[model samples]
Target: MQERTFQLLGLLGFILSGMFFTAAGIKSGDLLTLGGSLVWILACLIWLIPVLRDKDQER
Candidate 1:
């Protein structure tokens, strides 16, 4: 259950980060903002996948 929660949260973060970066990029036109968003999005993807897969295997 904890793993499931982590996976869900991670996925949510990934999605939200994408949205945030898009808005930030449009609003500020700052490379750093866009870069930070990309980094967060990638982190979410990387962490979520392994956690989710581990949860599935446990089941």
Candidate 2:
């Protein structure tokens, strides 16, 4: 797969994680949702960081 695919998935995951975070905020007591969002954000970073590092190397 292309690097663009990873970049897109990372962005999508980040957005979805934000939405989950908002939901967690509204719910207040939902630790599960908050945890899930954190994990999602981590996964997104795992994907995005490599792409970003490669970009920086190019520059």
Taking the candidates one at a time, how many backbone clashes does each contain?
0, 0
lDDT of 1 at 56: 75
Q: What is the C-alpha lDDT profile of model 1 across 1-59, one tens digit per residue?
A: 67578669769967796878868886998887877777777877787787778877988
Candidate 1, residue 19: how far the Cα is off, in Å? 2.1
Q: lDDT (0-100) at residue 54 of candidate 2? A: 78
Q: What is the lDDT of residue 35 in candidate 1?
A: 79
lDDT of each: 0.78, 0.74
Candidate 2 regions exceeding 4 Å error are 1-16, 19-26
* Residue 31 alpha-carbon offset, candidate 2, angstroms: 1.4
